[model samples]
Target chain A: MPKNILSVENLNGGYEVFVGRRRVFVHAVDDVTFSLHNNEVLGVAGESGCGKSTLAKMIYGAIIPPLLVKGGSISITTKGGEVLNINKLSIDEVRRKIWWIEISYIPQNSMNVLNPLKRIKDQFIDVFRYHGIKMDKTETVEHLRDTLTTLGLPPEVINAYPHQLSGGMRQRVVIALSLVFNPRIILADEPTTAVDVVTQRTILSLLKEWRENNKSSLVLISHDMSVHAYMDDRIAIMYAGNVVELGSSLDIFKEPLHPYTRALIESLIRKGDKSIRKGLAGQPPDLINPPPGCRFHPRCPYVMNICRSEEPVTTFLDNDRYVRCWLYTSSR
Target chain B: MENENMLKIESVTKLYGYGILGLKKFKALDSVSMNVNLERPKIAVLAGETGSGKTTLLRIIMGIVKPEIGRVLYRGYDIHKLKGSTARWYRKEVQPIFQDPYEAFNPLRRVDSYFYDTVTNICGIKDKDEIMYRIDESLRFVGLSLDRVSGKYPHEFSGGELQRISIARALLTTPRILLADEPVSMLDATLRVGILNILKDLKEKLNMIIIYVTHDLSTAYYVGDDISVMYRGTLVEHGPISKVYQEPRHPYTSALLNSVLEPDPSLRDKYPAVKPSSLELKEFLIAGCRYANRCPYAKEICWTTLPPYIDVDGVNVRCWKHLDYKL
Candidate 1:
């Protein structure tokens, strides 16, 4: 049931952002669709100009120019089935064979990806010699000291230096240099947003132990629904750049069919539930010309009036939940 | 809320350079002290994490940094012993909200001219219909409106409406206290509780007292009633946010309330993880218990001294393993 490793479909991007001479556009990623399965994690969530790091920089190929990709398609697949597209490749074949071999991001500042005068094993051999890979520097420092002692890290943090580590050891050396090339899908935008709750639960249990030891597929953005309830297994959501909901992380934390994911899972922080959480009243809708028909219909609290003029659709909802809202189009 | 003694701050200490002619120092607030009860309207949360002096104790309670040896005292008046219109009336009764409402105002100015320059320099309002009726009553007490933020421009608002117009320009100087350093930590967990319900409705409709420097222990236990926490520059735990977050008794507040990440994916692998040490600025200039090297219950006299604040029942808690749960 696993293999869907990164899909996407009707995604669209935006941001020509001029403002003075007036070239606006903003749509930061509307009509978004979601996928990613293989060792599945998904998450995303929303708020804060709801682009979710412009849909994790258009699913990690890290798009450029005032951010382009005006329409759909992403694909990825790989594990040798090799579907690929990734917004029609080439930024040196998406940084030589899909950035870190089939997707590997992790951004959200670990001092903007290490290199403060190198030496966390030379930034893991400058990303394993920019993928050409060759080895024998004492077997690549004993496989980066056995992958930083299988992620519990401290192999003397590979001779320190990126400002001698801390901000959770340079986010565990940028998740052990985005696992040199064991990639398949990692994304992770707000990668435990500026570390601390125990280094955001040890960098989300080292990306759920490197996606259960390389089965891969993670994604995970964050606006913290308890860091997507401790690292997703399917969650999506977004707003003002669409994707009102998607499901399973035990059905969006036990049935949240979008009223902004039930006020963002009732504004979380539940540990022995004392209640009164509330929050979501407004603000998270300006993707410029946004509010025109369900860009979370003017801060949807079950708005109605055909959710301020149509555009609802998505609804699947059974085991693999989907929900787009007008109360899941009147429960289909 | 200033029936005198609005801020006391004694023994502050802010060190920067020293040692090798520059005699090296970086204490960033060590001899810390507190007191703000101007007839109780409090909200003191300088909770830590980011070199934990909590934005250098909110830039030393907003006189914008200066604490070599303490005493801030705003109403019992000592902000480094004011001069010239009493330090501009102690900077208009101490008001600051900065934690980036997109760089807290002046994106080519006009988020209502800092609400008509705090209604003409802290409510002296030289009429323009009483500075547009006190900037439409402090932007309708921060649910915002002055023609939905009139003449807007901190990039036309929305970082939760430019932090509710920077907390309605620090509540147009009816400011008894509102330091708010981490003001909704770069907002957006659903517009961070609409700026934490407009600072818990301006501390219950303007009795006003809010220090709220945060790291977000669930919106500081849903809009704090008092919490101190701060570490690496001391005040390891304060009181009453329902007894320092439900009886914490500091093992760094029970490892920061068991490293709060519960959105419940079946409590994903139960949380213990918290490495953070990579040591060396002489281990945060240790003089015993700077969280005793990630304390699990470190007792070699908790690394040599400084424990004592043990109240326990009324909950002050500094921790020598709760000094035998002292009664």
Candidate 2:
């Protein structure tokens, strides 16, 4: 079996939104458990507000105000064979040790993450300096130029401002910044959602090349299934803060076990297939007041009496696949 | 000459940033022309990436922006020259569905007010019962009803539902042409197909022409009857959807088609190589082919002069390579 790099168990997190004078707790991610293996790509896909991004933030140890992790623990095994619980670490410790060196995060919008006032080269220098790397200006510039050229970016972009480059080019520069530290794992949230098709293709290819070359793990979060189909080795389908199905990408696409997964795949508009595809009926449950029992039962087509009263336990299937549905349970 | 087509755009050119004193101008739409026949309603897709002038073309058609070189004709009447009542009639015939549903309406006000306003002002319905009837009927066409969103604000509806409401409001005018600018790009994947289906149904049932502007090729292939591929600020290829998707002649068109990531794992390794443009702004100012900088099949002549439109297999291709090929 492949060695697990990160293990999350019974993770529960939510946002506290204020409704007039009262405070309402929205359980965005609930009881989610998954393990990320070394040197593999794991894709997390679902509709918006399904808690995929919240789960990513929790895993990356980004627990800000109004967004709190209520339960469960996340443990990461470093290359030095030391196990560290992320939630137990202090904010200073996470910033100093865990962030940008052990694990990195790429946000949905590249412009938001990059400092508009700084040049591209200065940004790289700041990251290196923050990590206490002792390098002269010449050495840093040489290193950055080499890295940018290797990633197929022009060397002259180092001198340009953020607004000077196009949206796609700026996104590529953000990707380059994330990989400069050579972190063990990368958590990217919708990296290619805003770019064009051609730019998306290039970015996906560059990510694949980076992963293979460095032998690093990736936790890619996207709502587009086609992106997952192209980049992921293992796929996790999330619905209402729960992992509905987990399996190999090939098996999940060919014979999806969960009804939600099947509906999502069927709704995709493919090339050369002109048959009218229908979207799922109803909207995702409100996180503040989710329905009882299974969260997906209301929207699921294969709802049963048991599905409405009790949540189905995770069932292990053949070929290392897993599903959470009453239809797959032997007791049904 | 009197044009019999429903909409005719001739030599429309729009330039931005006239240098310091109108010196350094950037060409947004270069001498573009197209015709939309209303004999039978069809969906014409303006497909391109960002900054490809697709949105500008839609804006030009809607009369929101005026072109410096050419004019848009509606039923043989120049849209820019139309007077008070004539312009009002033109606005009733051509309505737009914006890209972001969240910004399409005022959040403080009720969503149904837009529906009622459209019926009263654009459709000229006076009676309250008639306005309500028209609003409800138009909502039904897009698989939504007035009751579902009767007194709700824009925040009450999800992105998909809000977009559906926007479409319903557009239908309130009973437009002959619907100008949709990336209507489904903001929607989720599951919701996109449903919205596209509603647009297709509207074209057939209401006998209306739809001009959909988007950067996505999958939805365009699904809903578009005729596809026009745009690069930089020019239409590189325009033809039947089947022919364009099956046998793309322009290098940019072929690249766009090949770049689409199909929802299948078996084809993961089959992606084509895409070379990122180093000088994006320079390419826009190129006098020859704007795509020559990134196109792999570009030649010396392609960088010197613009290519003429060549008819090949019933498709109009603007590439120099097609000049040597026999059609």
Instruction: Give the lDDT of residue B213 in candidate 2.
Output: 91
Q: Best by TM-score, which number?
A: 2
Top candidate on lDDT is 2
Separate clash counts for every candidate: 7, 1
Clashes of 2: 1
Considering only N, C-alpha and C atoms within 3 Å, which residue pairs clash in candidate 1?
Answer: B12-B70, B18-B22, B18-B23, B18-B24, B19-B22, B19-B23, B19-B24
DockQ of 1: 0.21
Tens-place lDDT per residue, model 2, B101-193, is: 999899999999998788877778899998889989988888888889898999888899999999989888878999999999888888888
Against the native chain B, each candidate's TM-score is 0.39, 0.96
Worst 10 residues of 2 chain A by lDDT: A312-321
C-alpha displacement of A241 in model 1, angstroms? Answer: 20
For candidate 2, what is the lDDT?
0.89
Native-to-model Cα distance after best TM-score fit, residue B20 in candidate 2, in Å: 8.0
